[model samples]
Target: MLSFPSRKHSSLRVALTALTTLAVAGGAAAIPTTSTATPNAAPKSWDETAYRGQVEVVRTPEGPADTEYLTGRVFVDQDRDSASDRRERGLDGVVVSNGRDVVTTDRHGRYRLPAYDNMTVFITQPAGYQVPVDESNVAQFHYNHLPEGSPELRYGGIAPTGPLPDAVNFPLVRSQLTRAQEQHCVIAGDLQTYDRTEVEYARQGAINDLAGRRDYQGCGTLFIGDVVGDDLSLYPDVKDLTSLTNGPARFLPGNHDLDFDSATAEHAFDTFRAQMAPAYYSYDVGDVHIVALNTVRYPCTPDVDNADGRRPECDDPENSPRYNGRLDENQLAWLEQDLAAVDDDKLVVVAGHIPLLTFADEGSAIHQVDQVREVYELLEGREAVSVAGHTHSIENMRTGDLVQGWQDLFGVEGLPFPHITAGAISGDWYSGELTENGYPVAVGRDGGRPGLLTLDIRGDSFRERYTVTGESDRVQTQLGINSPTYRDWYAERQAWNDNPEGAAPELGDPHVVIREDLAGQTWLTTNFWMGSTGSTVEVEIDGRRAGEATRTQEMRGEDQLIGPEWSDPHAVAQQLVHGGSVADRTMHLWRFELPADLGTGRHRAEVTATDAHGREYTDVLHFRVVDQP
Candidate 1:
C-alpha cells in the first residue's frame, strides 16, 4: 500500500511497470531510460523534508528539434538530517504528464515540455525507487494546474485551447498532518487488487491523487468495499495504500470480501473483519453519522435443514454461497437499533458496497435488499441519504413515490429514500490504459466521467457533486425524463444490442431532448426508482397546478430482493420487449394528458417534485400544442 514516498516516486513505478512490459523494439517507442544516479556517484545522505514544488506536463506532436522534450526540476527531501542540503539531484526519468500523454527527464534530472493548463501533472513512479515525505508519514509529491485558479472554476473547468507557459516546478518541504486543516474526505470504491501488479496498479492510481495538495487530510478516505478481488490477501496492500493518504482511512465490506472458508453467516466476513475491521459499523464526522453496512449474506438462501438457520454461528458454520447479496435479519435488526439511536434532526449517511437499488443488471438481486423499503420507511421524516458502490456507475436518482420506470414491479411508488450509487474508485474495474498521470481513465456506465463523489454536508441539507475524471468541475444533475417516445427508442435499441463481440454504435448522447408525443393517449412518465416510492410528483400546466402523483412497485414475494419482485412479466419485459401496456401499474411510466383546445404556440409545463422528506425539486418542460384540422 505504501509503495513510494511522493507522487513522483509512484508515477516512476508505474512508468517502470509500463516500460518493463513495453515491447522495446526498433519500431516500438523507446521510453527514456534515464537514471538519477551515475556510475561514480556517491550515496548521498537521505533528505528528510517533504518536497513541495509546482510541476506541469503537456502533450504535443513530435517536435521538429532533436531535443523537443523539456527538462524540469523536482526536489528530493530538502531537509537532509533536518538541514537544507544542496547535494541532491532531480529524480531521473520521472514520468510526468496528464495520465494520457507522457514525458521523461534529461541527464541532469530536469524535465521540460509544452504546457497544458488545468491538468494534473504527476510523476510516474520509476521502478525500484522512492520519494520524499513529511513528518506525519504522508507523501509529498504531484502538482495541480487550476489554470484558471481554484474556488472559481465553478463553470466548465480549464479551457482546452492554450496560452500556456514553458515551465512548472514543484517544491519540497517536510510537514505533518494537522488538526486545524479543513477536512476533505476521499470516497473510494472497490480497489479489488487481484495480484501484485494490480496492487501496484492500485497504488500508482490512487497514490498519485493522494500525494500532493492539502484537501482530504482531515476526514481522509473511506473505501466503500471490495478492497481486493476474491483474494483477501490484498488487504495489507490496501492498508499500505491508505497510509499514503493525507488523512485517516476506513472501509466497508463488499460481496467479494466474504470468507470463502466460512461455513455460516456468522463467520461469513471473518476474513474481511480480520483485515478491515468490523463488517457493519458507524462513525460520526462533521455532524454526519456514516454507517458502513455489510449487505452480502453468507448462504444466499437460508436452508431450514441447516442447524441454527436463523442465527447460525461462525465457529460451526454452514458452507453456502446462497447469499450473494443481502442484509441478514440480524444486521437489519442492528441497523434498526443503530438508526433508532440517532437524533431525527441529525444527518445519517448509510454507506455500503451493494446499493439498495441500481441501474445495473443484477440491480434488484445483488444490488438491493427485498426489505429495502422497510429500512427506508424507518428513516422516513429523518435527515438521511443512502450511498453504495458495487454498480461501478454514477447515478443520482431523486427519491419519490411515483413508480413508472424501473420501480413498476415492486408496487412501491413515490419517494422511499434518496439512494446514490457511488461509482467505483477503480472505475470500470480499472480497465483503461494508463494516462500520463500514471492512472487509468476509467469511465462510468452512464457515460458519466469518473473520479469520486464529494458530499458537502452542512447541517441537514447535503449537496452531492460528482467529480468526473480529468474534469475539475462536477456534473450536478443528469437531466432528461422518461417519455413514451424515448421509451420506445430505448426498447428498440436494448433488444437488438446484444452482440458481445461485435462493434457497437454509441448509446447516443446521454444529454438529449426526450421527445414525447403528447397527443392521443400518450403521457409524460417519470419512474423514480425504488427510493422514490414514497415521494410526490406535482405537474403544473401554464402556471396552473395540474395534479399530484404517486409511485408504485411490483412485489414478487416476501423473500425476494432484486428484479421485479411482484412484477408483471409483460411490464418487466417491455423495456426489452415493447407492446401494449402490461397488467400491473408501472410507476416508472408517468402519463399526463395534453389540455384540449390549445393553439400552436410554445407553452411551459412545470413539474415540481417533493421527496419523502418534503424537499422540493422543480423541472420545467417546454412543449407546443397544435390544433387538429
Candidate 2:
C-alpha cells in the first residue's frame, strides 16, 4: 500500500527550510518567499498589516435628479477604513467597467458610465494597488445594481437596490505584495460541494492546505469555477471555506452554480452574482492581467449552424432549456474592449468556467466555447495563458498541441498558447472511498488526484505546478504496471458491469508478471499528473542505464487514445473496487515496455520524471516475475 505522510500542519519556517533543502538537492526550485517590502524585490511573507475592507457607497440627496449615469471614485484608503474620506485623493487612469462599457478614472479618480436596470459595476484592480477584501478575504471591488430585484426564484436572487446611487466609490491600498515580480497564483477548480458534509471534506482537504500556506497572499486564490454543486444554498458554507484561507479569494461561476429555476438566460446566475462575484470580470497583479470570463450560456440558442451536427439541445430554450459552453454577445463585446485597453507587454490570463478549448471535451461542442476562434483572434500575438475548470481532469496542454476533435469541432489545428484544465477540487464529485484525512480519494478520470494549480510567475513567463490535496508537492506522479493479467481483468470487469453477475473475479498480484505475460507485452506506466509535451519520464531497472519512456498520447494532431488499453491501473483498481470514475485515456501518461526476456524474481525499477519546467521527481516500483502462477 502507498504510504502517505500524516496530515499535520507544518510551521512556515520548517516548511521553507525543507523546501530549500530539497531545492539544493536538485529538486524543483523552492517556492519564492513572500514579503511586503519593495516592488522590485521578491516577497518574504504575507502582508499581515495590509488594510482589509469593502467599497464606499455614497448616498444621494433626497431630490428627483438625473439618473442617466452612474459615478464612482477610486481612492487610496489612508485611514484603513472602507469609506473614502475628504482628505484622501483619488487615483487616476485606473480602469473601471459597468459590465459592458469600459472606462478609466479621470485625474480626480472619478469615473462615469451609462446607467442600467440590472448591472454590476467593478474596477480592474491595477497592479501595485490591492483592493479591499471583505471579512472572508473575498476581494470587494464591485457594486451590484438591480433596481427591481430578481424574478421569483427558489434561492433568493439579488435584492432590490431601489435606485442607482449618486456615487459608488472603490477603496484601494498600496501593497508591495501585489507589486512583486515573483508571484504564486492559486487556481482552484470545481469545489462542487453538494451539502454540508462535502463542505467539511473540503475544509479538511484543500482548504486546510491553503490555510497553512502564506505564499499566495499577493496574487491570491482565484477559484476558476463550480464553487458549489447544483445547490446554490451551499454558497455560504463555501464562503466559510475561503475565510480560512490566508489570501484574497476570488471566484468564477460554473455550470453547476447556476439557478436552474431562472426563466431566461439573462437571470440564470442572478443568485450567484448576488452572493459570489460578477458573472465575469478582470483584475491585475504585477504585470499579469487576469480576464475572468463568464463562458456558460444558459437556455442557449443555436449560435452556429447545424452543419457540424452538434448541440441539437440548444435549438429550444423555453420548453427544454440547457446550459452550454458559450459566451453571450455582450460578454464578447466587453472582452474586445477589455483586451484593447491592456498593454501588449502585459501577460494576459484568460480564465473562465468553461475552457475556450480543452483536451478532455475537445470533441463536445457543448463543453467547449462556441466562439473559440474569435477569442484566439482577439488574443493573437500577445503573451497569453488560458485556464478553465469544468471537466474534472488536469490537462497541461502547451502551445502547438493539437487534437483531432478540436479540428473536427472548431476547425482549429493547434493551441496558440498554453491552456490548462485545472483539476477539480471535488474530484469526480467526491466519489470513491474516504482517505485517513476524512475526504474521498476521488481520483479524476485522467488519474489525477484532487488538487489545485499554482502558476509561479516571473514577469511575463510562468511555470505551472499541481499540489494534490492532503499530499506534498513531491507526489507528482502515480506508478503502476499494466500486464496481460490486468488487461484481461479489465475486460472481464467491463463485461460483467454490462451484465450483472453473481460476483466479479478480482485480479490478483497487479505488480506481478509471468513469463507468458511478459511475452505478450507488459509496460511500466507513469501517470504524471501535470506532465506536458516538454515533460519527460525515464526508467532505470536494476541500476542499468536509464531509457526514456514513451508518452502514450503524443498530442500531435491525433485523436484521443481511450479505453482499457490506455487506463491507469492504480487508479482503476481503486475506482472499480471502491467507487469513482474509471482512470482511462489521459494526455499525460507515459509507458516503458518491460523486457520479455527477464529472469524470474523480484525486480525494482527507479523512475524519474522531469516536468516542462525542468522540475525533477523520482518514484520507485517493485514487481515480481515468475514462471507460473
Candidate 3:
C-alpha cells in the first residue's frame, strides 16, 4: 500500500497553533488535536492523503482476437493496488468516451467503443468516487492510443503504441469528500512558463499557496490552457509542480501549447494529449458538470470566413500558420452529444482556453470564439456558466451584460449566463519588477493581480471568488485617484516614451489634486477584480457619506472605454515606471466623482465594494486637496 503524508499541519501550524493557544489560555474547552468530524460535517477539508496507483492493462497469452473495438472495466480496487482482484466489484453505469462517442458501462462495468487511430479513450469520473492518481497527483483515467505516432516535429511527440491490448481496466476508490454538497473548484489560467526560471516563480507564487491550502481536493484544480509557452519539452517540469498540489490536476490545450511544427491541426495537440490530457473532455463532481474544450484552431486557412478581417498570414499554410479561437466541426458536434447525456438538474460549467466572448479583446474577432452563438444555443434554457483563460485578464461578466463588439460581430446583444475570464497565472508573461517573495509582481493587463478563481459550489448554485497569489482573500480591490493633473502627466509620459529624452518626468503626486484640477473633473477609481453588473461600490469621505460610484464600462451594448481618464492609476504607476502591459482599459473599474468645492487639506476616503453575492470588501485611500502643484 502507498502511504501519503497529511498536509493538516504542514502549512497552517503557525496560525492553527495561535488559535489553539488562545483557546487554552481562555480556559475554554480544548479543541481536538486531530480531526474527528463525521462525513456529514458542514465544512470538511481534504487531508491530502490519497491512494496512489495507476490503470491496470490486462494482457493474455496473445492480444485480444477482436481488434475492431476497445473494451474497458471500471471497478472498485479494495486492495489499493492497480490490478483488479476477484473480490473487487465492478461499478456499473459509469460514463466512458472515445473522444467523440460517449458511452456507459454495462451491468458488469464493461464498456466497448469503436476503435480508431489517434483516438483517446477516457472515462468521466462519476460523483462520490475518485480515479487513482499518479505520483504527481494527476488524475490517471485516460488511455492515449496512437497506433502510429505523430509525424516528424521539433518536439518529440507521442511514441507509437504497438497494438491493441486484451483489456484496459480502470480502478476507482470511494471518496466522501466528493459526495459532499459543498465543493471548491479551482479554475487556474495561463501558467505559460517559457523556461525554468518562470517555473520556479510559479512554484513560489500560486503553487506555494495551493500547497498550504486543503480546501480543493475533491473537485480538483483545472489548468485551462497555456500550460507551457510553446515549449512542449517543459511538460515534465510542469507536472512536477502539480505533484505538490493537494488535488488531482487536469489541463486543456491552448495556442501556446500547440505543436507548431505539425503539418495539420489533427496532430497540433498530439504531444499535449500524450503528456497532459485529451483535447476536450467532461466530468461530474457533486451537482456540477464541467466540460473542458479545446477552442484553438491552429494553422487556420483563409477559406473559413470566421474572423472580422482577413488573416494574410494564414494564406500559405506550408510557410506560415496562425491560430484562431474557433472550435472544429467534430468537437462542436461532440459537445452537443456530451451535453445531451448530462442531467438537466446539474450545473453545467463550460471551460475552454480562449473565451467565447471577452471584454479584454472585445473588438478583436480572432481573439474571441467564432461560433459563439452556436454554443449559446446548445446550452439554452439550461443552468450554465462559462469559464476561460487566454486574455490574461480577469473578467466577471454577468448574464444580460452586453458589449457593442459582441453585437457587431457575433450578434450577441446580452450574455445568457455568466462568463468569467480567470486571470493568468503567468501575469503579463512574468514581466515587471521582482518582489521580495522571489516572484515578479506581474499585474495583469486589466490592472488585476495574478490570481486563481474558485467556484464555491453548493447544490446546483455557485459563488465565485478570486484569491490573489500569496495574498489573503481580503485583498480584493485597488484604490487610486484620477485627476486632470494625472491625465496631463500621463500624456507627457507617453510622448516622452515615443522620443528619447534625458530623464522622464514623474507625476509629482498622484494622490494630490489642485482646486483647478478638481474643478475640471476628479474621480476616485476602484479596480474591483471580481466586480460585475450586480456589484456596487460606495465611497465615504472623512466620515461623510458620498454617493454610490458608477462603473466606467457598463456592459450595456456600448463600446470599450479607453484612455487615461478610465485607466487604473494605481496599476499604471507601476507599469509605466517599471515594465509591463498598461492598464488603460477594463470592464471592472468603478469611479466616484470627488466634491469639486472641497477645502485645501488632507482627506480620507473609505470605499466599500459589494459583489453580486452580497460579500463586501472595504479599502481606504488618503489624498490631499492641494492649492497648487
Candidate 4:
C-alpha cells in the first residue's frame, strides 16, 4: 500500500472571468469566400466585442475541408419566446468552443468557429447566465449537430442533424433560487454521444430539466463520466446543455475519457485533461473533502526484459489492458499527498467512474485493482466513503469479504474497504423515446427508476437519498431473487418472445415461492444497492430490535457457478440467474432462534437497513410463532 505524509496543499483559486479567448486555427485555413463576401456583409475584423456566448470547433482526422465548426448565440429571453427574436440581442463576451479551441462571443453575443463532424460546441456560461447540471452533476450545453438518421456506432442513440440551422441558439432566463432548485442537481451517464444527432439527443434529453429553476443557488453540478460515448469531440455540445442549467457544473473522467489519438500513458488521458481537469483531484465543500480519482488506464506497449520486476506487465503497456486497472507512481504519490493534507477527521468522500468493488463480471479483466485494497487501507478508520459509477447498474454491496469470492481472477483476496457503485443516472443508455425534458426515461438492470444519489454529509455521518424519476426518495433494498427454479423458465420465456422456434425448455412450476427455512441458523446477505462499509442491517423480531448485523466481509470475486449442487430441474431453474442464494447455511449471516416468549397470533417484525451514507430502509416480515403440535 502506498501512503503520503500529511501536509497542507494550497487552496484552489476561484475562477474569476468566465470568458476565455476564442480559439482560432492552429494552422490557418483559407478564409471561406462565403464569410469574406460583401463590404457590409461580414462584421468588421471579427468584431470581438458584440459577441456574448461561446463557440467551439475541432479539426478532424480529415483535412481542413472536412473540418467542422459549431457556432452559437446565447440570447437573453426578455419576452421569453425560447427563440431569439430580431430585437433580442445575443449576450456578449460569453466563452465558447470545445475545451481546446475556445472562443468568446462577440459584442453581438454571436460566435462561430470551425469544428469537426460529431464534435461538441458550447459556451463557458458567463456569471449571469447559469449552466445546467445533470443528475450526475454533468453540465448542459450545445453540440454542433444532430443528424436525422442514425450514425454508425456501437451505442446508437443521438438524434439526427438537419441542415445547419441559421444559428444554434442558447437562451437564458433571468435567475431565481427556489428551494427545490436551491439544492438541485442533474445526473447523466455515458452521454457517449458518438455523432452529432446523439449530441442533440443528449441536448433534448437534458435541457428541459434546466428551465426556470433557482434552488441550486449556483453551487454548480458534477457529471461523472463516459461523457460523449467514446467521441471526445462532442464535449462542447455537452457543455452547451449545461448552459440551460441554473447552477455551476463540474465533471469527473471515466474509462471513456481517453484520447485514442495518443498511444501511451503520457498522452493517454491528455485529451481528457485538456478537455476537463486533472484526472484525479479534489475540492472542498462544507466540511467535506470530495476526492475524485482517475482509475482508468490507456494500455501501453510491452517493456523490454520486464525490467521493474514489479509485475511483468507493469512495464508493458500492451499487457496493461489485460489487467484493466491503474494509478501511476505519480498519482499514487499525489493521492497520498492529497490525503495527507486533509484534516484526518474531515469527512472525505471519494468519487470515481469505476467502482472499487462490484458484482458485475468480477473476475473479468475490467474490474478495479488488487492495489485498490491498499488505497482503502490507507483510509482505514477515517470518516470516509467511496462512490463510483460506470457499471451502468444499481448495486449497493455494503459488506461481505470484498475479495473473498472473486479475487482469484485477479489473484487478490480480503476486504479492502467500503465502496458504492452509485449506478448510472442515465440508466441503460437513456433507453426510451425522448421526453420533453430533453432526456429519456432510462432505467437500470433491476428496473429501478432513473435517478441520482444526493449526499447530505453532516460531520462523520451522512444521509444519502436515491431520487428516482417521477418518484421521491425511493430506495430498493432487496433485488428480489429473479428465482432459481425459473432460470430455465425465464430463459424459455425470453427465447419464446424472441423466436418461437428457438424456444427454451418448457416453463416449470415457476410460481412456487421459496421461503427461508431459517431453523435458527440460516444467514441472509442483502445487497442494498450502494451500501458502503459502515452501513448496518438490523433485525427486529415482533417489533423489538433483535440485533445489529456487523459488516465483516467484502463481495469482490469471480462467480462460483456451483450451488447446492442444485441438479433438480425445477430448483436449478429458479436459482439460475437470480444471483442471490443461500451459502454455507451457517457462516457470516445469522439465523437465530425465535424467543419462545413471543406468543404469536400474527407477528410483524421489520428489518431496518442503515447505510454508511445514512440512508435508512425498512421492510416487514409477517409470521406466526405458534406452539408445535
Highest TM-score: give the candidate number. 2
Write the residue-wise lDDT of candidate 4 on 460-526 in tens digits.
4454445444332434343222233334355455455456565346543332223322233222233
TM per candidate: 0.48, 0.92, 0.91, 0.53
Sorted by TM-score (best first), the order is: 2, 3, 4, 1
Q: Which stretches of candidate 3 lie over 4 Å from their true place?
A: 1-48, 304-313
**Candidate 3 per-residue C-alpha lDDT over 1-629 given as tens digits, one digit per residue, 9 for 90 to 100:** 11122222111111222211211100111122222111232244443457688888777778877788778788998887988877888887677777866667766778877778878888888889888888888888888788778888788777887687677888999887677667788999999999999999999999998887777888899999999999999999999999998888999999999999988888999889988988998888887889999999888877763344634555667776888888988789778767776776677899999999999998777788888999999898777999999999999999999999888888898999999999988988898999899899988889998889988877668778788888777778898888888888888887787785888969877788888888787999999999999999999999886679999999999999999999998888888777788899999999999998788999988888888776777788888988878
lDDT of 4 at 403: 43
TM-score of 1: 0.48
- Which residue pairs clash in candidate 3? none
lDDT of 1 by residue, 491-510 (tens): 44454555434543232322
Model 1 score (lDDT):
0.48
- Model 1: number of clashes? 100
RMSD (CA, Å), candidate 3 to true, equals 10.4
Angstrom error at residue 504, model 1: 9.3
Task: Output the worst ten-in-a-row residue range by lDDT, candidate 3.
Answer: 19-28
Q: RMSD of candidate 4 to the true fold? A: 15.4
lDDT (10s digit) by residue, model 2, range 66-184: 58888778999888888888798898767777888777777778877777998999999998999988778888989899989999878988998888887889989988878876777
